[model samples]
Target: MWVNCRRYAVQAHNIGCYKTQQRPWVRQLEATYDVIVKECGLFVDQKRPFLGATPDGLVGDDTLVEMKCPYAARDLTPLEGVRKKKKIL
Candidate 1:
Protein backbone atom coordinates (compact mmCIF):
# COMPACT_ATOMS: atom_id res chain seq x y z
CA MET A 1 0.00 0.00 0.00
CA TRP A 2 1.14 3.52 -0.70
CA VAL A 3 0.69 4.50 2.95
CA ASN A 4 3.40 1.98 3.87
CA CYS A 5 5.79 2.76 1.01
CA ARG A 6 9.04 4.68 1.59
CA ARG A 7 8.85 6.32 -1.85
CA TYR A 8 5.36 7.58 -1.04
CA ALA A 9 6.60 9.13 2.18
CA VAL A 10 9.47 10.86 0.42
CA GLN A 11 7.20 12.16 -2.35
CA ALA A 12 4.73 13.49 0.23
CA HIS A 13 7.51 15.32 2.01
CA ASN A 14 8.83 16.69 -1.28
CA ILE A 15 5.45 18.20 -2.06
CA GLY A 16 5.55 20.22 1.17
CA CYS A 17 9.06 21.43 0.42
CA TYR A 18 8.22 22.34 -3.18
CA LYS A 19 4.90 23.98 -2.32
CA THR A 20 6.78 26.82 -0.62
CA GLN A 21 9.09 27.17 -3.61
CA GLN A 22 6.15 27.23 -6.03
CA ARG A 23 3.99 29.71 -4.12
CA PRO A 24 5.13 32.78 -6.04
CA TRP A 25 4.31 31.19 -9.40
CA VAL A 26 1.00 29.90 -8.11
CA ARG A 27 0.06 33.33 -6.81
CA GLN A 28 0.81 34.87 -10.17
CA LEU A 29 -1.41 32.35 -11.92
CA GLU A 30 -4.20 32.92 -9.38
CA ALA A 31 -4.05 36.65 -9.98
CA THR A 32 -5.11 36.04 -13.57
CA TYR A 33 -8.39 34.82 -12.13
CA ASP A 34 -8.67 37.96 -10.01
CA VAL A 35 -8.75 35.91 -6.82
CA ILE A 36 -6.84 37.14 -3.82
CA VAL A 37 -5.39 34.12 -2.10
CA LYS A 38 -4.49 33.92 1.53
CA GLU A 39 -2.67 31.39 3.65
CA CYS A 40 -4.78 29.12 5.82
CA GLY A 41 -4.14 27.06 8.92
CA LEU A 42 -5.73 23.85 10.09
CA PHE A 43 -9.49 24.17 10.46
CA VAL A 44 -10.93 21.97 13.17
CA ASP A 45 -14.64 21.34 13.19
CA GLN A 46 -16.15 22.62 16.41
CA LYS A 47 -18.12 19.45 17.08
CA ARG A 48 -15.46 17.08 15.76
CA PRO A 49 -12.05 18.20 16.83
CA PHE A 50 -10.40 15.10 15.48
CA LEU A 51 -11.66 15.85 11.97
CA GLY A 52 -9.75 18.74 10.46
CA ALA A 53 -8.57 20.14 7.13
CA THR A 54 -5.69 22.38 6.25
CA PRO A 55 -6.34 23.80 2.83
CA ASP A 56 -3.51 25.16 0.72
CA GLY A 57 -5.10 28.55 0.16
CA LEU A 58 -8.37 30.28 0.88
CA VAL A 59 -10.02 32.39 -1.75
CA GLY A 60 -12.29 35.02 -0.27
CA ASP A 61 -14.83 33.64 2.24
CA ASP A 62 -16.41 30.79 0.35
CA THR A 63 -13.64 28.91 -1.40
CA LEU A 64 -10.91 26.54 -0.36
CA VAL A 65 -8.05 25.47 -2.60
CA GLU A 66 -5.66 22.55 -2.58
CA MET A 67 -2.45 22.80 -4.56
CA LYS A 68 -0.17 20.13 -5.95
CA CYS A 69 3.31 20.53 -7.38
CA PRO A 70 4.14 17.26 -9.05
CA TYR A 71 7.83 16.68 -9.72
CA ALA A 72 7.48 14.31 -12.67
CA ALA A 73 4.98 12.94 -15.20
CA ARG A 74 4.72 9.75 -13.15
CA ASP A 75 3.84 11.82 -10.11
CA LEU A 76 0.32 12.08 -11.56
CA THR A 77 0.06 8.44 -12.60
CA PRO A 78 -1.76 7.34 -9.45
CA LEU A 79 -4.51 9.87 -9.98
CA GLU A 80 -4.83 8.83 -13.61
CA GLY A 81 -5.30 5.25 -12.54
CA VAL A 82 -8.00 6.24 -10.09
CA ARG A 83 -9.84 8.16 -12.76
CA LYS A 84 -9.67 5.24 -15.14
CA LYS A 85 -10.90 2.86 -12.48
CA LYS A 86 -13.79 5.14 -11.62
CA LYS A 87 -14.85 5.24 -15.26
CA ILE A 88 -14.74 1.45 -15.50
CA LEU A 89 -16.98 0.97 -12.49
Candidate 2:
Protein backbone atom coordinates (compact mmCIF):
# COMPACT_ATOMS: atom_id res chain seq x y z
CA MET A 1 0.00 0.00 0.00
CA TRP A 2 1.21 3.51 -0.82
CA VAL A 3 0.37 6.74 0.97
CA ASN A 4 -0.34 9.95 -0.82
CA CYS A 5 1.18 13.10 0.74
CA ARG A 6 0.25 15.91 -1.61
CA ARG A 7 -3.48 15.38 -1.77
CA TYR A 8 -4.31 18.45 0.32
CA ALA A 9 -1.68 20.50 -1.43
CA VAL A 10 -3.10 19.58 -4.80
CA GLN A 11 -6.60 20.46 -3.70
CA ALA A 12 -5.48 23.82 -2.39
CA HIS A 13 -3.68 24.50 -5.62
CA ASN A 14 -6.88 23.76 -7.55
CA ILE A 15 -8.86 26.14 -5.35
CA GLY A 16 -6.29 28.87 -5.79
CA CYS A 17 -6.44 28.41 -9.51
CA TYR A 18 -10.22 28.73 -9.40
CA LYS A 19 -9.99 31.93 -7.38
CA THR A 20 -7.47 33.35 -9.84
CA GLN A 21 -9.84 32.68 -12.68
CA GLN A 22 -12.22 35.36 -11.36
CA ARG A 23 -9.71 37.98 -12.44
CA PRO A 24 -10.73 37.70 -16.08
CA TRP A 25 -14.33 38.39 -15.19
CA VAL A 26 -13.29 41.74 -13.76
CA ARG A 27 -11.31 42.51 -16.93
CA GLN A 28 -14.23 41.65 -19.19
CA LEU A 29 -16.49 43.90 -17.17
CA GLU A 30 -14.08 46.81 -17.53
CA ALA A 31 -13.71 46.32 -21.27
CA THR A 32 -17.48 46.18 -21.71
CA TYR A 33 -17.85 49.38 -19.71
CA ASP A 34 -15.21 51.23 -21.75
CA VAL A 35 -16.77 50.19 -25.01
CA ILE A 36 -20.17 51.41 -23.88
CA VAL A 37 -18.63 54.69 -22.83
CA LYS A 38 -16.82 55.14 -26.15
CA GLU A 39 -19.91 54.27 -28.16
CA CYS A 40 -21.92 56.79 -26.19
CA GLY A 41 -19.99 59.68 -27.80
CA LEU A 42 -16.98 59.80 -25.47
CA PHE A 43 -14.83 59.90 -28.63
CA VAL A 44 -11.41 58.42 -27.90
CA ASP A 45 -8.33 60.40 -28.86
CA GLN A 46 -5.87 58.27 -30.82
CA LYS A 47 -2.92 60.59 -31.32
CA ARG A 48 -1.43 60.21 -27.84
CA PRO A 49 1.68 58.08 -27.33
CA PHE A 50 1.70 55.13 -24.94
CA LEU A 51 4.24 55.14 -22.13
CA GLY A 52 4.24 51.54 -20.96
CA ALA A 53 3.50 48.00 -21.99
CA THR A 54 0.10 48.10 -20.35
CA PRO A 55 -2.93 49.37 -22.24
CA ASP A 56 -3.05 53.15 -22.51
CA GLY A 57 -6.78 53.06 -22.11
CA LEU A 58 -9.52 55.05 -23.85
CA VAL A 59 -9.02 58.78 -24.12
CA GLY A 60 -11.92 60.74 -25.47
CA ASP A 61 -12.31 64.42 -26.26
CA ASP A 62 -13.57 64.99 -22.75
CA THR A 63 -12.61 61.73 -21.02
CA LEU A 64 -9.62 59.60 -20.16
CA VAL A 65 -9.42 56.37 -18.22
CA GLU A 66 -6.08 54.90 -17.26
CA MET A 67 -6.84 51.64 -15.61
CA LYS A 68 -5.36 48.58 -13.96
CA CYS A 69 -6.43 45.54 -11.99
CA PRO A 70 -4.70 43.92 -9.06
CA TYR A 71 -5.32 40.69 -7.19
CA ALA A 72 -7.00 41.28 -3.84
CA ALA A 73 -4.82 38.77 -2.01
CA ARG A 74 -1.53 39.93 -3.47
CA ASP A 75 0.81 42.78 -2.68
CA LEU A 76 -0.18 46.24 -3.98
CA THR A 77 3.24 47.82 -3.67
CA PRO A 78 3.21 49.03 -7.23
CA LEU A 79 0.36 51.47 -6.51
CA GLU A 80 2.53 53.36 -4.06
CA GLY A 81 4.51 55.01 -6.83
CA VAL A 82 1.41 56.02 -8.75
CA ARG A 83 0.18 58.52 -6.17
CA LYS A 84 3.00 59.54 -3.93
CA LYS A 85 2.25 61.31 -0.69
CA LYS A 86 5.03 63.53 0.51
CA LYS A 87 5.99 62.44 3.97
CA ILE A 88 6.11 65.31 6.40
CA LEU A 89 9.00 64.47 8.71
Predicted structure with the largest lDDT when compared to the true one = 1
What would the TM-scores of all predictions be?
A: 0.55, 0.22
lDDT by residue for model 1 (4-88), tens: 3334334443656454645764576477678877877668779986666667678889998765554443334445735655311
Stretches of candidate 1 off by over 4 Å are 1-20, 71-89
- Per-residue lDDT of candidate 2, residues 1-89 (tens digit): 01233333343224554356434533554565554222221222467532212222334565544333334424434345334432110
RMSD of 1: 9.1
lDDT of each: 0.58, 0.36
Window of ten residues with lowest summed lDDT in model 2 = 36-45
User: For candidate 1, what is the total of clashing residue pairs?
Assistant: 0
**Clashing pairs for predicted structure model 2, backbone only:** none
Model 2, residue 55: distance off in Å is: 7.8
